[model samples]
Target chain A: MNVLIVLAHPERKSFNGGLVDVAVKQLEDAGHQVEVGDLYAEQFDPVEHAEQYPHSAVASDYFYPLNEQRAHYQQDTLPQDVQRELARLEWADLVIFQFPLWWHAQPAILKGWFDRVLVYGGRYTSRMRYDHGYFRGKRAMLSVTAGSPGIAFQPFGRAGDMVAWLWPMHASLYYVGFDVLPPQVSYGVQGGGIEYQKEDALRIHLNACKECWATRLAHWEREKPIPFAGWEDWNSEGVLCETSPWRWRLG
Target chain B: MNVLIVLAHPERKSFNGGLVDVAVKQLEDAGHQVEVGDLYAEQFDPVEHAEQYPHSAVASDYFYPLNEQRAHYQQDTLPQDVQRELARLEWADLVIFQFPLWWHAQPAILKGWFDRVLVYGGRYTSRMRYDHGYFRGKRAMLSVTAGSPGIAFQPFGRAGDMVAWLWPMHASLYYVGFDVLPPQVSYGVQGGGIEYQKEDALRIHLNACKECWATRLAHWEREKPIPFAGWEDWNSEGVLCETSPWRWRLG
Candidate 1:
């Protein structure tokens, strides 16, 4: 199996950094060819600009369905690093997004990655479907670290569960084609001795990534789709039904 | 009664443009001073950078609670236009965000505004507990336009309604202390070909803006808060709490 890790974080010594290392090791030990896109280390520019898609390039004709953003897909040159990351995404069987949660979502750089690399024709709507552009069938997972305690994330608590909080990321990824899996989250990341926490978090991340890969590999060979327990039955299109906090709370 | 309009759409002929014009006109008619920060027109860069806050100029030293983003925040110079817009936000009694809905949420530029302007020590997380951050007493309202038919956005439709879809936006804005009002969404924006529909939509927007201003004015004068049946109560926390089908449906 070929796996790609899209890692975002400024500090290589951070727990997120350890998680990245653990994920790489686990996939490699499992006999998969693993590649890492150390976004910050590579200084991957998250900002999508006109330069990202060069008109000189034959493939530049791809169009995103939305009208407001066509200029970005056409105008500027994509930074070299971002282009390279896109290539990795194109080659991967499994894509892993590793980062710390910021403002209850991905950091600007990671968000920028989506803003740019997931082009209209490539990842979402295209000129073929003037009204309905989408992403169809890939697999992805998130590995995140939150500073708050785990219990603080319930509906009755301060912030909701990290999984529930990440609806936008999941929906956006799944809406296009990625089979969105549940994420691995490390809570109480602000304390517990920085060095020890980093190691523990890394180990936990490794186990989560391995489990995710095993499940995907299982489904890859199976006739049935991998089932999601939390969501309702898949819709007619095979996408999971949309559910929200109230539903979760009521249930 | 000073109002600031932060318009995100780039196209002047767009219905979003018309809404902007109407909002400005209505605010002015109510005798409030209005400032328009037509983001795209002014070329406001939403990217945050080191230049945005010089050590000498920064009021709050903290970028993140843990202080990890200082370097990233200061990397690029805060673009002049965004700086000017932030200044305007500081000067206004109310801020109106006007944009077309993209993928069931804010356009990237508007999202970028939150990414940049709502700085750690500046717009958010003031050292003083109760008096935290700038833009405290200031109000905010989202003026959004949707492309689908209005009926397609109801609870029974594929995607839920627009109100529930806006929870995060309302939550984030409220957490930061904006006395948020329920957002104003013009559903069925694509149905503008129907004369009465367009007229009715425009009227709804016009009246809503007028009422919003009146509410703010009344609140400032220590009078009762403004009320509109269904509109204001749609989302009790000044955000629409209901769901829309467009959010869940693929089409």
Candidate 2:
């Protein structure tokens, strides 16, 4: 199997980066081809604007992101970095996002990855998203680190539910047709109550997380993807049907 | 009242910009002082890195974001843009985030604003978050535009719950002690089912949304802020207490 690990962190020696190294070694040892995309190392330009499109397809006066994206994609004139990411996605059977959760979500750099790399007309159209997404058969998962403890992120915890905070990302992955797996969250990565426990305690926790991640990857295929309501489960108005299991949560 | 509308859109002529214009006019007419922070126009760098902290108090080899933030803030040496934003926050009683929803959240530029501007030690400490956050008395709301129609973002709509998508952002604002109001979502800004209604229909819709927003702004002071669990509501481990009113949703 081919795998792509996208790392979004400023410091290469950070715990988030350490997890990427662990993933690479683990996946490679399992006889899989692995490539890591270190976003910070690449100096990825995150802001999407008129500047991203040097070859103008839209009017000089206006910049509609979707229109420009569609045009560039159709012309095969996308930016080099975007082209490289798309190529990686095309080659990978599974993709892993490695990052520290910031402000209850992925950092801005990773957020921009979804904005730029996923071309509209080429990657997803009105009919091409959800179960029919361009990368449907592929899989994606988030490996996140947080500053707060696991208890703080429990359901109704002070730090908020990890699942709820990650729902946008999970939903986006599902929208684009990846079989989304449940996230592997390494909580209390630094500071918070863990600091009172002692500084080296974080070091110990990091190693333990690395071991847990490796074990999970080896037996990953046995796990089922997290469930999501698909097209068939919704009515013409795009809402869940009466028989849909998702109703209980929404209600 | 002082209001700051931070806009994160590429095109100034876009509908998102139009909403900001409508807001400025409405709030100003109501005798409130208002300021607009055009992130794109300012060319705000979204990627936070070691370079952002020019005066490094940490060792040259390693860069920890929170540590650097705390050090720089202690020295009163935060990035100019961040300092400016912090000043704006200090002056404002209410803040409005105006942007089109990209991939179910704020655009990368706006997301970066939170990452960069919310200083670790100064803006929030482990003890100074959630209900006890620094900006507790201030109010914040998201004025968002979407490509999909309202029906598609219903409880279990295909576009997914708008509430779920914006949860991370809402939670972030709440963390920093802002009373997060329910978002003003102007759905179907373009494409999707709206385009079938003809391109000019989007124009009509934009105008109507502007009117609606202006009308709402007139009575905004009366609207109660969205409720979130406070510090008192949580136990020592940070989990919500059994008697808490928030338990119903968690269960």
**Candidate No. with top TM-score:** 2
* lDDT, model 2, position B239: 89
After superposition, the stretches of candidate 1 with alpha carbons farther than 4 Å from their true spots are A38-86, A126-137, A161-164, A191-251, B10-13, B41-86, B126-136, B190-251
True contacts kept of each: 0.02, 0.80
Q: What tens-digit string does per-residue lDDT give for candidate 1 at A1-251?
A: 78888887656666666677777776676687889887667666554433444453432332222422333345444446655766787788778898777656676667767765766544555232211323234467787877656665644334444544576676556555666666667765652224444477655654564455444444432233223222233244323346533323321
Question: Chain A alone, TM-score for each of the models?
Answer: 0.68, 0.95
Per-residue CA lDDT of candidate 2, range A48-113, in tens?
989999877966667788889999999999989999999999999999999999999989999999
The docking category that best describes candidate 1 is incorrect
Q: Model 2, which residues run further than 4 Å from truth?
A: A191-198, B191-198
Please report, in order, the local distance difference test score of every candidate based on alpha carbons: 0.56, 0.87
- Report the Cα RMSD per candidate: 9.1, 2.5
Q: Looking at model 2, give its docking quality level.
A: medium
Cα TM-score per model: 0.66, 0.96
Minimum summed lDDT over a 10-residue window in model 2 chain A is located at A190-199
lDDT of 2 at B92: 95
Query: TM-score of the B chain in model 1?
Result: 0.66
